[model samples]
Every structure is written in structure tokens, then in C-alpha cells.
Target: MPYINIKITREGVTAEQKARLIAGATQLLVDVLGKNPATTVVVIDEVDTDNWGIAGEQVTRRRERGR
Candidate 1:
């Protein structure tokens, strides 16, 4: 079995976005990686601003500054 994990830190992640991302990722593994979707597992983790950093700064701070 194939296990896939996708971690993203951002606001406003819709159901459609998750579906598309999973589909695309699965397709990539199936087509490019020569894996089977039936045996592949995809997991998405949505993290808060504090869990992610950008430019050596925390995203929560940027959002506070409206940047």
C-alpha cells in the first residue's frame, strides 16, 4: 500500500480544494510513480499559523499585521 501525506498551512481550505489536491496527488502516483490508487493512502494535515513559518517569521504574526 502507498501512503501519502500532504501538509498545508493556510486559511480557507475548502472541500473542493482537498478533493482536487487528493485526486491530483493520487494521479501523480498512479501515472508517474506507477502506483495504484486503490492501494494508495492520502492524508492531509491543516496546520494553524503558529505551526508554520515564513521568511523566518511565524504566519500568525503576519496575519496580525494584515500582510
Candidate 2:
């Protein structure tokens, strides 16, 4: 079994895109490692901009600055 965790900023990701991500991740494991799709686990975590930070600033502020 393979466990994969994917984290992304919750800005404008659509359900279709997320579905593609899950499917693609599962297929990657199946194609590259011969893992069973049924046994593969993929979890997507969306973090709020306020909760995510980088370069000593929150993601919300960074986006506001447009840098």
C-alpha cells in the first residue's frame, strides 16, 4: 500500500482539478511502482492562505503584495 499526501493552497482549485490530481497520483504509483490502485491512498489537504506562510509573511499578505 502507498500513502501519499498532497497539500495545496485553497485559492481557486476546482473539484475537477482535484479529481484529476487524485487519479493522476494513483496512476503514477500504479505505472511506476506496480502498486494496486485499490491499495493506494491519496489525501489532499487545502490550507487557508492565512494559515500558510513563507518568507516571514503569511500567504494572504504575500498575495496582497503580489510578489
Candidate 3:
């Protein structure tokens, strides 16, 4: 089994983004990694803003408020 794991920021995450991510990942696995797209598995994880930070600043609270 070919497993693909993806992690993205909580901001601006959408279904179309997820689909495009999956498609691009699948293509990379097939074309570059030489994996079979048929047997490949893709997993996308939307990480909480607080769970990540930039410039040592937390954005979890901001993300929750926006939601």
C-alpha cells in the first residue's frame, strides 16, 4: 500500500483544496515515486491553527473565531 499523508493549515481549507491535494499527491506518487495510483492511499489532515504557529505566534484562537 502506498500511503500519502498531508497536513495543511486550518485557514482557508476547502473541499476543492483537499481534492486538488489528493490528485496532485496521487500523480506525484505515480509519476515520480513510481507507485501505482490504483493501490495508492491518500490521507489529508486539517491541522488546528493552535496546533501550529508561525513566527512563534499562535493562531488557534483566531481560527476558531473565524469559524
- The TM-score, computed over Cα atoms with residue i paired to residue i, of candidate 3 is 0.73
Candidate of highest lDDT: 2
TM-score of every prediction relative to native = 0.83, 0.91, 0.73
lDDT by residue for model 3 (1-67), tens: 5898987776677899888999999999888878888888899887777787766666776556673
Error of 2 at 62 (Å): 0.8
lDDT of 2 by residue, 1-67 (tens): 8999999989999999999999999999999999999989999999999999888889999999896
Candidate 3 ranges beyond 4 A from true positions: 54-56, 59-67
Computed on alpha carbons, the lDDT of every model, listed in order, comes to: 0.90, 0.94, 0.81
Clash count per candidate: 0, 0, 1
lDDT of 1 by residue, 4-63 (tens): 899998689999999999899889998887997998889999999998999999999988
Model 1 segments beyond 4 Å from truth?
Answer: 64-67
The TM-score that candidate 2 achieves is 0.91
User: Any residue pairs clashing in model 3, and if so which?
Assistant: 50-60
